[model samples]
Target: MLKLDDANIEAICGQAAQLPSPSLPEVAVIGRSNVGKSSLLNAVLGKRGLLRVSQEPGRTREVIFIRVGTRGYVVDLPGYGFARVPLSVKHAWGRLVEAYLARRARGVMLLLLDIRREEPSPGDMQMVDWFRHYERRFSVVLTKADQIPRGRWKSASDGIARALGLDKDNPPFIVSVKSKEGIDSIRRLLTQGLMAE
Candidate 1:
Protein backbone atom coordinates (compact mmCIF):
# COMPACT_ATOMS: atom_id res chain seq x y z
CA MET A 1 0.00 0.00 0.00
CA LEU A 2 1.13 3.53 -0.66
CA LYS A 3 1.97 5.73 2.27
CA LEU A 4 -0.68 8.21 3.31
CA ASP A 5 0.48 11.53 4.67
CA ASP A 6 -0.27 12.30 8.29
CA ALA A 7 -3.86 13.44 8.59
CA ASN A 8 -4.70 16.71 10.31
CA ILE A 9 -7.06 15.97 13.15
CA GLU A 10 -9.42 18.17 15.18
CA ALA A 11 -11.47 17.14 18.18
CA ILE A 12 -15.10 17.40 17.11
CA CYS A 13 -17.12 16.50 20.21
CA GLY A 14 -17.09 15.22 23.71
CA GLN A 15 -20.69 14.25 23.22
CA ALA A 16 -22.20 13.65 19.80
CA ALA A 17 -24.31 16.78 20.10
CA GLN A 18 -21.11 18.80 19.97
CA LEU A 19 -19.79 17.16 16.79
CA PRO A 20 -18.42 19.40 14.11
CA SER A 21 -20.40 20.33 11.09
CA PRO A 22 -20.38 17.82 8.23
CA SER A 23 -18.39 20.23 6.12
CA LEU A 24 -16.32 17.51 4.43
CA PRO A 25 -17.27 14.07 3.19
CA GLU A 26 -16.70 11.75 6.16
CA VAL A 27 -16.25 7.98 6.30
CA ALA A 28 -16.72 6.25 9.64
CA VAL A 29 -15.19 2.92 10.65
CA ILE A 30 -17.37 0.86 12.98
CA GLY A 31 -17.12 -2.58 14.57
CA ARG A 32 -16.90 -4.46 17.82
CA SER A 33 -13.75 -3.76 19.77
CA ASN A 34 -10.63 -5.67 18.68
CA VAL A 35 -12.11 -6.42 15.26
CA GLY A 36 -8.95 -4.97 13.69
CA LYS A 37 -10.52 -1.62 12.77
CA SER A 38 -7.52 0.32 14.08
CA SER A 39 -5.07 -2.06 12.48
CA LEU A 40 -6.95 -1.79 9.23
CA LEU A 41 -6.83 2.00 9.38
CA ASN A 42 -3.09 2.02 10.04
CA ALA A 43 -2.42 -0.54 7.33
CA VAL A 44 -4.43 1.27 4.70
CA LEU A 45 -2.62 4.50 5.47
CA GLY A 46 0.80 2.80 5.55
CA LYS A 47 1.31 4.08 9.05
CA ARG A 48 1.66 2.26 12.34
CA GLY A 49 -0.14 3.42 15.47
CA LEU A 50 -2.20 6.10 13.76
CA LEU A 51 -5.13 4.57 15.59
CA ARG A 52 -4.52 2.82 18.86
CA VAL A 53 -4.80 -0.98 19.04
CA SER A 54 -6.05 -2.59 22.21
CA GLN A 55 -6.14 -6.18 23.37
CA GLU A 56 -8.91 -5.24 25.74
CA PRO A 57 -12.05 -4.02 24.03
CA GLY A 58 -13.66 -0.58 24.28
CA ARG A 59 -10.49 1.35 24.76
CA THR A 60 -11.54 4.11 22.39
CA ARG A 61 -14.16 6.36 23.91
CA GLU A 62 -14.69 9.30 21.55
CA VAL A 63 -15.55 10.07 17.94
CA ILE A 64 -12.17 10.98 16.44
CA PHE A 65 -11.17 12.36 13.06
CA ILE A 66 -8.26 12.04 10.67
CA ARG A 67 -8.35 14.33 7.69
CA VAL A 68 -8.11 12.48 4.37
CA GLY A 69 -6.51 15.03 2.16
CA THR A 70 -8.47 18.15 1.31
CA ARG A 71 -11.54 16.30 0.00
CA GLY A 72 -12.50 14.03 2.93
CA TYR A 73 -12.04 12.96 6.54
CA VAL A 74 -11.82 9.57 8.24
CA VAL A 75 -13.70 9.16 11.50
CA ASP A 76 -12.86 6.49 14.06
CA LEU A 77 -15.69 5.86 16.42
CA PRO A 78 -15.63 4.14 19.83
CA GLY A 79 -16.11 0.41 19.58
CA TYR A 80 -19.09 -1.52 20.90
CA GLY A 81 -19.21 -4.77 22.94
CA PHE A 82 -16.33 -4.25 25.28
CA ALA A 83 -17.30 -6.39 28.23
CA ARG A 84 -15.35 -4.55 30.91
CA VAL A 85 -16.63 -1.08 30.24
CA PRO A 86 -19.42 0.19 32.45
CA LEU A 87 -22.96 -0.04 31.12
CA SER A 88 -23.23 3.71 31.48
CA VAL A 89 -20.22 4.21 29.25
CA LYS A 90 -21.57 1.80 26.69
CA HIS A 91 -24.88 3.58 26.66
CA ALA A 92 -23.13 6.90 26.26
CA TRP A 93 -21.09 5.54 23.36
CA GLY A 94 -24.24 4.23 21.73
CA ARG A 95 -25.90 7.62 21.97
CA LEU A 96 -22.79 9.28 20.62
CA VAL A 97 -22.64 6.96 17.62
CA GLU A 98 -26.33 7.30 16.97
CA ALA A 99 -26.26 11.08 17.17
CA TYR A 100 -23.17 11.40 15.00
CA LEU A 101 -24.71 9.20 12.34
CA ALA A 102 -27.95 11.08 12.49
CA ARG A 103 -26.42 14.53 12.24
CA ARG A 104 -23.52 13.99 9.86
CA ALA A 105 -24.98 14.88 6.47
CA ARG A 106 -22.14 13.39 4.42
CA GLY A 107 -21.41 10.22 6.38
CA VAL A 108 -20.40 7.07 4.53
CA MET A 109 -20.05 4.44 7.19
CA LEU A 110 -17.77 1.42 6.79
CA LEU A 111 -19.00 -1.40 8.97
CA LEU A 112 -16.26 -3.87 9.88
CA LEU A 113 -16.94 -7.48 10.79
CA ASP A 114 -14.60 -10.23 11.84
CA ILE A 115 -14.21 -12.97 9.21
CA ARG A 116 -13.69 -15.77 11.73
CA ARG A 117 -16.90 -14.69 13.39
CA GLU A 118 -19.57 -15.34 10.79
CA GLU A 119 -22.52 -13.44 12.26
CA PRO A 120 -23.28 -9.99 13.54
CA SER A 121 -24.10 -9.42 17.19
CA PRO A 122 -27.49 -7.96 18.04
CA GLY A 123 -25.70 -4.66 18.49
CA ASP A 124 -24.17 -4.98 15.04
CA MET A 125 -27.55 -5.59 13.49
CA GLN A 126 -28.90 -2.57 15.34
CA MET A 127 -26.14 -0.44 13.86
CA VAL A 128 -26.78 -1.77 10.36
CA ASP A 129 -30.47 -1.09 10.67
CA TRP A 130 -29.73 2.34 12.04
CA PHE A 131 -27.70 3.18 8.96
CA ARG A 132 -30.45 1.83 6.78
CA HIS A 133 -33.06 3.87 8.59
CA TYR A 134 -31.07 7.04 8.10
CA GLU A 135 -30.61 6.25 4.39
CA ARG A 136 -26.85 6.50 4.68
CA ARG A 137 -24.53 5.18 2.00
CA PHE A 138 -22.40 2.45 3.53
CA SER A 139 -20.69 -0.89 2.98
CA VAL A 140 -19.66 -3.78 5.19
CA VAL A 141 -16.11 -5.13 5.36
CA LEU A 142 -14.77 -8.39 6.81
CA THR A 143 -11.45 -7.95 8.55
CA LYS A 144 -8.67 -10.39 9.60
CA ALA A 145 -8.69 -12.21 6.25
CA ASP A 146 -5.30 -13.89 6.72
CA GLN A 147 -6.33 -15.70 9.90
CA ILE A 148 -8.84 -17.87 8.07
CA PRO A 149 -8.04 -20.54 5.49
CA ARG A 150 -8.33 -19.57 1.83
CA GLY A 151 -11.05 -22.12 1.03
CA ARG A 152 -13.00 -21.27 4.16
CA TRP A 153 -13.08 -17.57 3.25
CA LYS A 154 -15.70 -18.14 0.57
CA SER A 155 -17.98 -19.89 3.04
CA ALA A 156 -17.30 -17.32 5.76
CA SER A 157 -17.94 -14.42 3.43
CA ASP A 158 -21.11 -16.12 2.18
CA GLY A 159 -22.34 -16.67 5.70
CA ILE A 160 -21.67 -13.05 6.57
CA ALA A 161 -23.57 -11.84 3.53
CA ARG A 162 -26.54 -14.02 4.41
CA ALA A 163 -26.55 -13.02 8.04
CA LEU A 164 -26.19 -9.31 7.29
CA GLY A 165 -28.94 -9.37 4.61
CA LEU A 166 -26.43 -8.45 1.97
CA ASP A 167 -27.04 -9.98 -1.42
CA LYS A 168 -24.71 -11.52 -3.96
CA ASP A 169 -24.62 -8.18 -5.73
CA ASN A 170 -23.29 -6.37 -2.62
CA PRO A 171 -20.91 -8.77 -0.90
CA PRO A 172 -18.43 -7.74 1.76
CA PHE A 173 -14.75 -7.53 0.98
CA ILE A 174 -12.41 -9.76 3.00
CA VAL A 175 -9.39 -7.82 4.20
CA SER A 176 -6.27 -8.44 6.27
CA VAL A 177 -3.91 -6.01 7.94
CA LYS A 178 -1.23 -8.69 8.21
CA SER A 179 -1.30 -9.54 4.49
CA LYS A 180 -2.51 -6.22 3.06
CA GLU A 181 -5.36 -7.71 1.08
CA GLY A 182 -8.23 -5.52 -0.12
CA ILE A 183 -6.55 -2.29 1.03
CA ASP A 184 -6.40 -0.86 -2.47
CA SER A 185 -10.02 -1.62 -3.18
CA ILE A 186 -11.04 0.11 0.05
CA ARG A 187 -8.94 3.14 -0.80
CA ARG A 188 -10.45 3.28 -4.28
CA LEU A 189 -13.98 2.85 -3.01
CA LEU A 190 -13.39 5.51 -0.34
CA THR A 191 -11.92 7.91 -2.85
CA GLN A 192 -14.81 7.41 -5.21
CA GLY A 193 -17.39 7.51 -2.45
CA LEU A 194 -16.04 10.76 -1.00
CA MET A 195 -15.38 12.40 -4.35
CA ALA A 196 -18.75 11.53 -5.86
CA GLU A 197 -20.59 13.90 -3.57
Candidate 2:
Protein backbone atom coordinates (compact mmCIF):
# COMPACT_ATOMS: atom_id res chain seq x y z
CA MET A 1 0.00 0.00 0.00
CA LEU A 2 3.03 2.28 0.01
CA LYS A 3 2.79 5.09 -2.50
CA LEU A 4 5.71 7.04 -3.98
CA ASP A 5 3.67 9.24 -6.29
CA ASP A 6 4.63 12.14 -4.04
CA ALA A 7 8.31 11.68 -4.86
CA ASN A 8 10.06 14.64 -6.38
CA ILE A 9 13.71 15.29 -7.04
CA GLU A 10 15.05 18.38 -5.28
CA ALA A 11 18.52 18.55 -6.79
CA ILE A 12 21.06 16.87 -8.98
CA CYS A 13 24.77 17.20 -8.43
CA GLY A 14 27.96 15.51 -9.51
CA GLN A 15 30.28 16.97 -6.89
CA ALA A 16 29.98 16.51 -3.16
CA ALA A 17 29.97 20.24 -2.49
CA GLN A 18 27.05 20.79 -4.86
CA LEU A 19 24.85 18.32 -3.01
CA PRO A 20 21.93 19.81 -1.14
CA SER A 21 21.85 20.22 2.63
CA PRO A 22 19.95 16.89 2.83
CA SER A 23 17.17 17.84 5.21
CA LEU A 24 15.65 14.35 4.95
CA PRO A 25 16.88 10.78 5.27
CA GLU A 26 18.39 9.38 2.07
CA VAL A 27 18.49 6.03 0.28
CA ALA A 28 20.76 5.53 -2.70
CA VAL A 29 20.49 3.10 -5.60
CA ILE A 30 23.78 1.95 -7.10
CA GLY A 31 25.01 -0.80 -9.40
CA ARG A 32 26.77 -1.51 -12.67
CA SER A 33 25.49 -0.05 -15.95
CA ASN A 34 22.22 -1.40 -17.42
CA VAL A 35 21.27 -2.95 -14.10
CA GLY A 36 17.71 -1.47 -13.96
CA LYS A 37 18.40 1.37 -11.52
CA SER A 38 16.26 3.68 -13.63
CA SER A 39 13.46 1.18 -13.95
CA LEU A 40 13.36 0.56 -10.24
CA LEU A 41 13.34 4.26 -9.48
CA ASN A 42 10.52 4.85 -11.91
CA ALA A 43 8.54 1.99 -10.42
CA VAL A 44 9.08 3.29 -6.90
CA LEU A 45 7.88 6.73 -7.87
CA GLY A 46 4.81 5.13 -9.48
CA LYS A 47 5.68 7.08 -12.59
CA ARG A 48 7.41 6.00 -15.72
CA GLY A 49 8.90 9.22 -17.08
CA LEU A 50 10.26 10.43 -13.77
CA LEU A 51 13.53 8.73 -14.61
CA ARG A 52 14.64 8.58 -18.19
CA VAL A 53 15.04 5.01 -19.38
CA SER A 54 18.04 4.71 -21.62
CA GLN A 55 19.10 1.75 -23.68
CA GLU A 56 22.68 2.89 -23.52
CA PRO A 57 24.61 1.94 -20.44
CA GLY A 58 26.23 4.62 -18.30
CA ARG A 59 23.88 7.29 -19.55
CA THR A 60 23.37 8.85 -16.13
CA ARG A 61 26.48 10.97 -15.75
CA GLU A 62 25.59 12.86 -12.60
CA VAL A 63 24.19 12.13 -9.17
CA ILE A 64 20.42 12.67 -9.19
CA PHE A 65 18.58 13.58 -5.97
CA ILE A 66 14.90 12.59 -5.90
CA ARG A 67 13.02 13.95 -2.93
CA VAL A 68 10.10 11.94 -1.60
CA GLY A 69 7.03 13.72 -0.23
CA THR A 70 9.04 16.02 2.02
CA ARG A 71 10.02 12.96 4.02
CA GLY A 72 13.30 11.72 2.50
CA TYR A 73 15.47 11.49 -0.56
CA VAL A 74 16.18 8.70 -3.01
CA VAL A 75 19.50 9.23 -4.74
CA ASP A 76 20.35 7.54 -8.02
CA LEU A 77 24.00 7.24 -8.90
CA PRO A 78 25.75 6.54 -12.16
CA GLY A 79 26.53 2.94 -12.94
CA TYR A 80 30.05 1.65 -12.36
CA GLY A 81 31.20 -0.54 -15.19
CA PHE A 82 31.49 -0.71 -18.98
CA ALA A 83 30.32 2.69 -20.01
CA ARG A 84 31.29 3.58 -23.55
CA VAL A 85 32.90 6.76 -22.30
CA PRO A 86 36.40 8.10 -22.11
CA LEU A 87 38.76 6.96 -19.39
CA SER A 88 38.75 10.40 -17.77
CA VAL A 89 34.96 10.38 -17.50
CA LYS A 90 34.98 6.92 -16.03
CA HIS A 91 37.37 8.02 -13.34
CA ALA A 92 35.22 11.04 -12.63
CA TRP A 93 32.23 8.78 -11.96
CA GLY A 94 34.35 6.80 -9.52
CA ARG A 95 35.36 9.92 -7.61
CA LEU A 96 31.79 11.15 -7.47
CA VAL A 97 30.52 7.79 -6.21
CA GLU A 98 33.32 7.37 -3.72
CA ALA A 99 32.81 10.83 -2.29
CA TYR A 100 29.05 10.37 -1.95
CA LEU A 101 29.32 6.94 -0.34
CA ALA A 102 31.87 8.12 2.17
CA ARG A 103 30.23 11.41 3.13
CA ARG A 104 26.45 10.93 2.91
CA ALA A 105 25.19 10.92 6.53
CA ARG A 106 22.05 9.09 7.59
CA GLY A 107 21.88 7.33 4.28
CA VAL A 108 21.26 3.66 3.51
CA MET A 109 22.66 2.25 0.32
CA LEU A 110 20.61 -0.16 -1.81
CA LEU A 111 23.16 -2.20 -3.63
CA LEU A 112 21.38 -3.63 -6.70
CA LEU A 113 22.28 -6.82 -8.51
CA ASP A 114 20.34 -8.58 -11.22
CA ILE A 115 18.47 -11.64 -9.93
CA ARG A 116 19.48 -13.53 -13.03
CA ARG A 117 23.11 -13.27 -12.09
CA GLU A 118 24.49 -15.98 -9.85
CA GLU A 119 28.01 -14.63 -9.50
CA PRO A 120 28.61 -11.17 -8.21
CA SER A 121 30.64 -9.03 -10.53
CA PRO A 122 34.05 -7.67 -9.52
CA GLY A 123 32.65 -4.18 -9.28
CA ASP A 124 29.79 -5.42 -7.08
CA MET A 125 32.23 -7.13 -4.75
CA GLN A 126 34.35 -4.02 -4.52
CA MET A 127 31.33 -1.91 -3.63
CA VAL A 128 30.35 -4.34 -0.88
CA ASP A 129 33.88 -4.22 0.47
CA TRP A 130 33.80 -0.46 0.51
CA PHE A 131 30.51 -0.46 2.40
CA ARG A 132 31.90 -2.85 5.00
CA HIS A 133 35.09 -0.88 5.38
CA TYR A 134 33.15 2.34 5.93
CA GLU A 135 30.62 0.71 8.24
CA ARG A 136 27.81 2.01 6.07
CA ARG A 137 24.33 0.59 6.44
CA PHE A 138 23.36 -1.11 3.19
CA SER A 139 21.19 -3.90 1.79
CA VAL A 140 21.48 -5.80 -1.43
CA VAL A 141 18.51 -5.87 -3.81
CA LEU A 142 18.30 -8.53 -6.48
CA THR A 143 16.48 -6.93 -9.40
CA LYS A 144 14.80 -8.58 -12.39
CA ALA A 145 13.26 -11.26 -10.25
CA ASP A 146 10.73 -12.03 -12.95
CA GLN A 147 13.48 -13.37 -15.11
CA ILE A 148 13.68 -16.46 -12.97
CA PRO A 149 10.87 -18.80 -12.04
CA ARG A 150 9.14 -18.12 -8.71
CA GLY A 151 10.14 -21.50 -7.28
CA ARG A 152 13.82 -20.70 -7.77
CA TRP A 153 13.82 -17.33 -6.04
CA LYS A 154 15.09 -18.63 -2.74
CA SER A 155 17.86 -20.72 -4.22
CA ALA A 156 18.92 -17.79 -6.39
CA SER A 157 18.90 -15.37 -3.49
CA ASP A 158 20.94 -17.76 -1.39
CA GLY A 159 23.42 -18.31 -4.16
CA ILE A 160 23.88 -14.61 -4.64
CA ALA A 161 24.40 -14.13 -0.91
CA ARG A 162 27.01 -16.84 -0.75
CA ALA A 163 28.79 -15.39 -3.75
CA LEU A 164 28.87 -12.01 -2.03
CA GLY A 165 30.05 -13.57 1.24
CA LEU A 166 26.90 -12.49 3.05
CA ASP A 167 25.39 -14.83 5.63
CA LYS A 168 22.48 -16.98 4.44
CA ASP A 169 20.17 -15.02 6.71
CA ASN A 170 21.29 -11.82 5.04
CA PRO A 171 20.22 -12.63 1.51
CA PRO A 172 19.59 -9.83 -0.93
CA PHE A 173 15.99 -8.77 -1.48
CA ILE A 174 14.49 -10.38 -4.54
CA VAL A 175 12.24 -7.98 -6.46
CA SER A 176 10.60 -7.88 -9.84
CA VAL A 177 9.39 -4.57 -11.15
CA LYS A 178 7.21 -6.31 -13.70
CA SER A 179 5.42 -8.57 -11.25
CA LYS A 180 5.28 -5.97 -8.44
CA GLU A 181 6.84 -8.44 -6.08
CA GLY A 182 8.99 -7.13 -3.23
CA ILE A 183 8.39 -3.50 -4.21
CA ASP A 184 6.56 -2.74 -1.01
CA SER A 185 9.34 -4.28 1.02
CA ILE A 186 11.81 -1.92 -0.61
CA ARG A 187 9.53 1.02 0.08
CA ARG A 188 9.30 0.12 3.75
CA LEU A 189 13.02 -0.34 4.00
CA LEU A 190 13.56 3.02 2.42
CA THR A 191 11.02 5.10 4.35
CA GLN A 192 10.96 3.13 7.61
CA GLY A 193 14.67 2.30 7.86
CA LEU A 194 15.65 -1.40 7.72
CA MET A 195 12.42 -3.20 8.49
CA ALA A 196 12.31 -6.98 8.85
CA GLU A 197 13.28 -8.31 5.41
Worst 10 residues of 1 by lDDT: 1-10
Q: Which digits, one per residue and each the tens of the lDDT, describe model 1 over residues 15-78?
A: 9767887887887889888888878877776678677887878767888888877777778888
TM-scores of the models, in the order given: 0.93, 0.90
lDDT of 1 at 44: 73
Pairs of residues clashing in candidate 2 = none
Model 1 quality (TM-score): 0.93
* Residue-wise C-alpha lDDT for candidate 2, range 1-197, written one tens digit per residue: 43568887678887767866645677889998888898998887788888877878887778998877756778898898874689998788878888887774576889999888878899999899988887777889999888989999888888878888886565688888899999888877776642212
**Candidate 1 lDDT score at position 5:** 58
Clashes of 1: 0
